[model samples]
Target chain A: MSEPPQEQPRPEAEIDTPPRGLPQPEPAAQPPVPAADSGAAPGPGAGAAPVWGAGPPAPPTPQRRRASTVHVLQVIALVVGLVGTGWISSEHFRTVWLGSERDEPVAVDGAGAATHEGLTVSLVEATDLGATPSLPGTDWQPPSGFHAWRVVLDAESTNPDLFACDVALVDGGGRHFVANLFVDSFVDGFEWTFSCGVPEPDDDVPAQQALLVLVPADAEPTAVEITSTGFSSGYIELEID
Target chain B: MRRRWMIVGLAALAVVLGIATNVADARLLPYGPTSSTGAIGEDAGAYPFTVHVSQAQAAHTVLVCCRFETPPPTGTDGVWVVVTLSYATADRPRGASGTGLVLRSADGREFPVSNRTGSGGWLAGPDIWVRGDLAFEVAPDALEGLTLVFDPGIQLYGPMPTQYARIPLDLDPGAVLDVIELSEEQILGAGER
Candidate 1:
């Protein structure tokens, strides 16, 4: 009844193209139905809804727009806000409880020396500074009920890069004391050298590194320890006479 | 269903974040030195040092603390409270925080040493008790149940509590005098102790 369909007459593969010599059909794939011809039917599947080119091919969807500068900036800000706050909070908690502090140290007797990172520290002598010892005109002095003592150390090294160390006196009671840094001046060669003989660049460490410390009257210090403040925990414990 | 789930997820996230913030502020945020409280004449021990508050006094005219009279009659109406204390450290307090003394009253009023001459913040090595005086200016009525607080001056990175010596001071407001001389910080030598 629908005048034998034009494309249906052709083979399946050749439906897309007809011979050029053949008379040309209307421009569109299917002719539009007139409003007056309401009784006319479309393709086989066409009933309440008539789909165009539903069997052979479908129309291409419109391309989507690209992301905008504002959208990208919003994403970046969100990531930064979340990551920054999380990192700070976690970092604060992480630093609170350090797992360990001291490590097994290398022990050396009197007249012996220890070295780390190319720098060497040695104990030369231990002298007793009697009760009532005072470095007059200096900001530092021995407190009451304590005896002052001097631990002489000699240091030698050619390297000063990232160099920091602490030399402390240990009493028989396990008390530790380092040379006081607040001493304004060196009175009468009474030096409390906390440097542990760290020499200046290209210069020799002073011959005698006098480390003065105050020990309690009950127990006198029998040894001294040297440690680097950096990551490496390797240390030296030198005995005193 | 999906929309309801999204709302529930967002609400859960909000509650979690609220709890996290509260916990962080209460335990994590504060770091550095620790502190504590004590009474006069008693030995209080803290990290890096041990302290004892020996004496406390109040005066209007303080001797050897920058000026002869703390507050000139023309100046603010306040009284001078001087504290004498000593502390010993087995460890070096190098570059540590809180060397000066602070005066805290019963009602939570705090006053620090104002005058620079012979002021607070003296430290020494182990076995040696470093004796010093710290003077503060406070209202005449604020002298009741005064306490001297000393922060052991530890500025460590962790949440290590700073050792604080809060030794209560007893003074008679009526006993306020016109002149008082402050003692110099002295390292107790043999007989000097």
Candidate 2:
């Protein structure tokens, strides 16, 4: 109870109180800080204690006080925004560059069926046309040292939005090739439409397409994956029979 | 005193911002397309093709080339602006693929070639002249100061072309016709390189 106001510490670094040299209250009128007199640690730098009669430290004016608070809020928001942006950028790198497949892809057997968005794609059959694959009506043949792999798929979607699809093949060694890389837009009478068939406004029959791909004869392709932009999750990997 | 200076600074900032906005609206941005301007009845180099626009006409109904007899012409919401041009490639063989012609109006609006009317093209070799009719459906009010941006060497699935020819057409708004008969595109063989 006998500790002088000059010996009491100031509350916070940012609270701007009057200079310590200013006139203070009488020793008897000055309230003692319990912690200071009770042999406990005083408030941070409480050694400079606020001037006796002067209340708590504040900005010079009410407007300045508001401005100070706004500055503190702005700093907090800027730090939070920077942290959020960094987190998103790291996640993007992981998904695109590092090839961290966020979730396991939805996989089906060689001839199984799977639904994505509103479209259900079914792999009917896959055939390996070795070296030289010639259709009955056309004379188109694979180039030298190339093997033709044919894929027949049935795409059916009741929705008229007409979702487009991409068909790709992944070899046993993990080499990926898009459908059109080796095959023409049309092959063996059936058109390799990148789009799932246009189900008539009233008809329910699915559109069937026969796609062909030419790969190096030595390469062993293991799976054909079908993906649509409509699906945000991973693509569907259908094993090659 | 500081308040007066602050007001002056704000006014200056507003003036600078207004000027910047006007410049951006005038298509002066660095990312905007660079144009190769050409006038009607002039030899305009639209990428690989040197296009010579002979005439520009307006029609209410247009019988597009090839299959006009099967589908026939019908009433359209906008007038068809047909530009009859003779083009020849000077460089290597280039395929005139996809929708490459666009009509830029006086008010900065652009109308691409009507793809629904089946606009597609074949290959033209070095020095081979091709006679074709490029038609764009546009509102009658945009006829004034209409400029055609033709990029004949556009790719079907790749990065966009860098530059295109801007041909200004001298159109007659009062000359709206019933139907314009558009014939098939003729690939006139080489002579002028």
Q: Write the per-residue lDDT of candidate 1 for residues A1-241, one digit (tens) a residue.
A: 5587665644656446544454444638755554235576553433533322234334543432233555688789989999998878666456644545547666554458876666667888877777566656555555555666777877776555535467777876566766544333366555644454346667544666676666666666778887766525577788875
Q: Candidates' TM-scores?
A: 0.57, 0.36
CAPRI band for model 2: incorrect
How well is each residue in B122-178 modelled by candidate 1, as lDDT tens digits?
656555566777778898888988877766555454543455666778888888877
Model 2 residue runs over 4 Å out of place are: A1-241, B1-34, B65-71, B152-161, B189-193
Which model scores highest in TM-score?
A: 1
Candidate 2 chain A: worst-modelled 10 consecutive residues by lDDT: A50-59
Superposed on the true interface residues, model 2 gives a C-alpha RMSD in angstroms of 15.2
Candidate 1's DockQ: 0.28
Instruction: Kindly report which residue pairs in candidate 2 clash with one another.
Output: A8-A46, A9-A46, A9-A47, A10-A45, A10-A46
| Complex DockQ per candidate | 0.28, 0.03
Q: Clash totals for all models, in order?
A: 12, 5
lDDT of 2 by residue, B88-109 (tens): 5543446665467678898998
List the TM values for chain B, per candidate. Answer: 0.68, 0.70
